[model samples]
Target: MTAPAELDAAGITDPALRAAYTTCRELNARHGRTYFLATRLLPRERRPAVHALYGFARYADEIVDDLGDGRPVVEKAARLDALALELDRALDGALDRAVPGGAMGHPVLAALADTARRYDIDTRYFRDFLVSMRMDTTVTDYATFEDLAVYVHGSAAVIGLQMLPVLGTTVPRADAEPAAAALGEAFQITNFLRDVGEDLDRGRVYLPAAELAAFGVDRQLLTWCRRTRRPDPRVRRALAHLVAHTRAIYRRAAPGVGMLEPASRACVSCAFALYRGILDEIEAADHHVLHRRVTVPARRRAAVALPCLARAIVARTRG
Candidate 1:
């Protein structure tokens, strides 16, 4: 729980606003472990904005996905709707001339509004993201890759788009958008491949249903795999196919690392390597994602991060 140095660097000096940014930073560190690690590699000045984005997303996700017993789906949907409206108000409040940053009552949204204003990020991305969060309430599985792409675009791709400003791309946004989108999709698809069991427990399956059927997998088979903790060859095959597909997306996203501002490059490269590493770990385990979560070992993360650490230091020193 170190104080967020980035908040000060970003000119967020008001005591209440700084506290709001701190709350967002805590959310990122607590729930977004991998994402938090990535933020650590960024220029300290830029980290608060990334934390704000992650916090906003995590808050909405919890509302939709972490409801306890006796909470009906309708209630969760209504809560999600409330959140979307709150976000709308928060964004509008940012434009107010009288209030400083027009921060809303919700600390996370207040921090998010400040970041959005600072970066001149489009509000449409937030609206699209809320749409996907709302989708999680009812959409359990996708019928095709095309259908799934639409949801993932809102859920994950816009996140990368939202981050482009904070990351400080060297190229025009138009040139960089495709790569950012591919990277986002790659990360989410990797999560889907690794979290198949946990997602099933939540009564959701992110894998395209058609892809599953192509490998003779269905909901029941996935449940059996989860219960048995034994690898089914067909399941393994399907997972492998997805792993390869995700790798292709990673490849598509790789060049964007070089396209980021030099000060930001090391951080994003670190993240790209680390997330892509999850795909490798999944393969090494022979695609046995149904039984347990696959993760890059801490030692391995340290190894991958070492060079980026040096690059980040150089970038900071140059500044």
Candidate 2:
């Protein structure tokens, strides 16, 4: 459906709010290719909420990772702090009372606060997300996966938790929360593997340091491989190990797909298949993710999405 149709279906009528949601939808379409494709399968009314969530996330991520802008770490941290405060005001219904350059002035925050209020999503999830975003300005690499879990819980797992209200569920929401969080972790791990090269360029290593060490790999060795544009046997083994580890996460997340309300299932299922397909592409490339990114081919994406789209139509019709 078109943006207007989506907003109308969601009962959004305020001009400023519609504009904010439109901005978010644009962000999602431009940056979240796989995610946007899956979102197309959701009931139209739910699409704007999903876009708002993605926009909120994508904006924060760009603030942390916008290497070309050359902002200092301190500046980035301050910006995040300001964003967190603005979010608080937005959530508190104080956006209209703000001074210049405040909560009322940011479109992404506007859409997010509206969605949160509409769905009654917990406020703590947003707070936890900012906590992780703040860590990016200081923490470089994690010492172990266990240590990384702290960051991931805030950065990824809470994202899944935040979405539960919007997605609806067949069981009690708490019953599906674990699997939802697991799916988020799986997606984040897949991203860590695929973007290992780019993350290294940003002076951050997401793969656990200890795990890489087990394969006789370290930042310097990985850097050398990146610099030389060649893969090492050890690096391949390390990446292969990570690939298998990520698949385990996907397995853990699988059960939640069945727990989502029927109308929402097709969208989540399509996303699950496509995100996991990245691992297939990475392995197919012989674990050469150190120098380049891998993606599911367009044809493969269509192959997965078409069937899901049909299923989504049928589910929506039945509902």
Candidate 3:
């Protein structure tokens, strides 16, 4: 990780900059409370940088994904792309010099530029993330696993790549990076499975029509609210296979738990197990996603975290 030759104005210690940092902290705590809670368990030095990374990622994601009007998608993407470039300049230490001439600060970017330096997070990931955001703006369905993976790569995998530096790992040690990417894919695929009806209403079918046809399940039953399961053997037959695909991805995400630093392992472990548990719930319900979205309760989240937490604690004690 390289340090900047000179500090950007974003991190200048003037009273106004200090106040902005305070505001950023409060805003992140407000909107990112859950991620903040998880980060609190990490080593103290790692927490702020990680929170900042998550804060920026979540903010960028909210843009194209805003879902209110198509208008926000275009506006947010432009802002995000510009913000990404500003971050890059701060990283290079050559630009982002806050001109001598009067200039207004972008509130979020002001804080994020310092966070990038503090953690050595790469600039490219932030840039690539928007390309993924563009996909969300235009592409919403999956025809093949290849296409699905491409979408996941831009949306989720790059996020893991961004976080890698904050965890204090080198690119070579970045071997664990792939596992992190897989874990994110697990999170995304679960979201898609759970949101099938919602996505379909927007004229998207995450579960391919071709694959559904294999089961004799028509689009109306899958997209409409009437039936959660099928009376036909072909539908039943196809769903069993679909459920397994969900399970397989969860299994793929499991090994990544150990890939995270021990202090950060608990949250990922809980998420992984809870998502797998949801898959089990889907199986138990016979894949009836329409009646309700499957969820692992708070109790279950705590229960899943216990084992990983204990393991992390024990490892620290020995060390």
Candidate 4:
């Protein structure tokens, strides 16, 4: 369905609200390539909410990462704080009041607050996400996966929790929560591996310091590899280990596809396949992710998505 048709199907009639959702959909379409492809397989009415969620995430990530704008860390932190305050006010019914140039004035926040209200999504999950976004301005590296898990719980895991309400579930929501969160962690870990070079350029190292240390890899070695656009055996070994670790996460997350509502299962399953396929691409390149990003080819993406799209149509027909 087209964007306007999606808004109509979702019962979103207000002009400003539709505009807000449209802005979010644009962000998702432009930035979240694989994710946006998966979302297309969802029922049209549900697509706007998923777009809102991803839009909010991508906005916050841009603020923290600055997307090569060379903004000062203090400026980014201030922006993040302002966003958190705005989000808090937005969640507290400020948007319904429609105060001039307030929380509702921001398109991404406007859409997100609407989604949160509609789904009764917990406020704490959004709060936790901001806390992690705040961490990016200060924390540079994690000592171990345990320490990284603290960051991931806020950065990644809560995203899945936020999504559960919108996606619906076959079992109790709580019953499916673990795998949902695991899937989020897996996706983020894959990103960390794929973007290691870019993240290093941004002065952050997401991989666990201890894990790299075990393979005699450190920020210096990674930076050297990124600078020279070359790969080291030790660096390749470290990436190989992390890729295996990420595959285990994908395994842990696999069963949750069954836990989703049938109509939603195909969308999540397609995303699962595509994101996991990044691991395959990385491995196929012999884990040479230090100097460049790895991606699933467009042909491979189409091959995975077509079958799932057909499945989604059948599931919706049955429902």
Candidate 5:
């Protein structure tokens, strides 16, 4: 509903492309409530690029998760493959290329293509992300954290890697990559904690079997608890362990916030606090993530946001 600030900062002038980027921003605002909130702390020109990135990820995710019901697994795999091919073409400088049969006038792809070129973001990151989405269609559970890292590399880590360019880091990418990756994985693990029940409904388990076993928890027990709405002490213990692990990762990721360009610092800092707030919410709710999604309250969001908003305004005014 808000006007996308596209004229000066993003260098987008074409009416069609501006509209495409606006559509992506709308998607980011609609579905990724926390993400969109953090994005608001970015300088206005920078917001659209972040939104385009989210749009690209969200489009592929919807194909894998939302459209999966009643469809054959083979059909879903084919769709993913088709999308990968289309993405490949777009990244290779051919936006108008049709997806095999017909023209695919997807605005997300259009905006993503523009953003990728603008920021010189690597195509490999996009490739890895699509690979993970493809894996989600078939892989239901992980045996070990090490085994799951293979999936997380693509789904989570590369996302931060992709975003680093847009965020404009102060140091070489190699110097910041570790912190970026740690932060990304931390956010993803937090999601796993909050969405255990929902993932079970989709016939998936994100928690590593080995780690769950360490806490005396298992998939069958988790499924039973979800069905019965009974909270097990062991399950609570397992979630607490996960929360602690994610907190450590957030610590590892924290130093990288200072590595970003001054104007981008507040945005990433706000995101860091807001996402870490979910873990705090889980603790406050007594780790009852199995029953409902835990969230940072609007008042808490505003509280975190107010300081970052002030910092961002100062950064922009000085620029």
Candidate 6:
């Protein structure tokens, strides 16, 4: 991945968003090697915006995951809160998203701000995204599936909603926004499941606490299972069930992709393909995320393109 750049603006301190998106061709690598071809194929105008979202998300995620600051949690939390407010200001039109088209600082958010302004995506979603990031400070367990979904709505769903207006181009709020949200939800859940061990190590648990209790899985068991060299039976079962749930989400979710204007399919296709790979990788790992995180290889990623490509081609031919 390219380095995160500093935004010329007062708020967008991360620039990786701009560097990775200088070419949509690079996004496939940012998400995974399997997604490049499809990204190259996105709706021309919207691909850059999708790249902007990816970069934005990467920047926000790094705030929690970087682990380099070596500061007290209190300090980190406060910093994140301030960053969140800045991001909100950028969204509310109070500040620019970047240095400016011609300005200095961070090229990414600047480019992104331009992208957001050109489209009609709201500022609220960006604010919600910060809230989701702040959750990393202490939110380890979820009380229920609904609770998890609600959190996912803010963290991931908002990212999708932010991109809808960009994809619509002409109509702006076109038919795909809901589908985009579904896509975001599907991706985030799959990510949580796939990164069980990694999240656990961070002293964060993303699995539903209530569900884990019902499953007879406790925190100690979760810790041991995740820290081990191989996944235990309980972890395997829980992960498999989660993958199955993800499949269901995808089923409900895929329809939203089909609802988009044909031009927008590539954006959905690339993002969908990456998460689909995660689901597939989870299955291949025997749902053993407690043992290790699984990733799709390039060859398989290449295969992912065929189905989507053929579908896109057929859609265009028919159109």
**How does each model score on TM-score?**
0.97, 0.96, 0.73, 0.96, 0.94, 0.81
User: Could you tell me the lDDT of residue 66 within candidate 4?
Assistant: 55
**Alpha-carbon lDDT, every model:** 0.87, 0.91, 0.59, 0.91, 0.85, 0.66
TM-score of 4: 0.96
How far is 223's C-alpha from truth in model 1 (Å)? 0.5
Write down the lDDT that model 5 would get: 0.85
Runs of candidate 4 exceeding 4 Å displacement: 67-69, 94-103
lDDT of 1 by residue, 1-319 (tens): 2455576677778787888889999999898887888788887778889989999988888888765324788888898889888988888898554354585679999888888988888889988998998888889999999999989998999998999998988889889988988889899999898899999998999999999899999999999999999889999999998898899999999998888888888888888999999999999999988989999999999998999889988987896
TM-score of 6: 0.81
In model 4, the Cα lDDT at residue 120 comes to 79
Candidate 6: where is the Cα deviation over 4 Å? Answer: 1-37, 67-70, 88-105, 169-175, 306-319
Model 5 root-mean-square deviation:
3.0
Residue 291, model 4: Cα distance from true site in angstroms: 1.6
TM-score for candidate 3? 0.73
lDDT of 2 by residue, 1-319 (tens): 7999999999988888889999999999999999999999999999999999999999888889863247899899999998898888887762344222224458998888888878888889989999999999999999999999999998999989988999999999999999999999999999999999988989999999999999999999999988898989999999999999999999999999999999999999999999999999999999987888899999999999999999999999999
| Candidate 5 pairs with clashing backbones | none
lDDT of 1 at 50: 95
The collision pairs in model 4 are none
Report how far off residue 317 is in candidate 4 (Å): 0.6
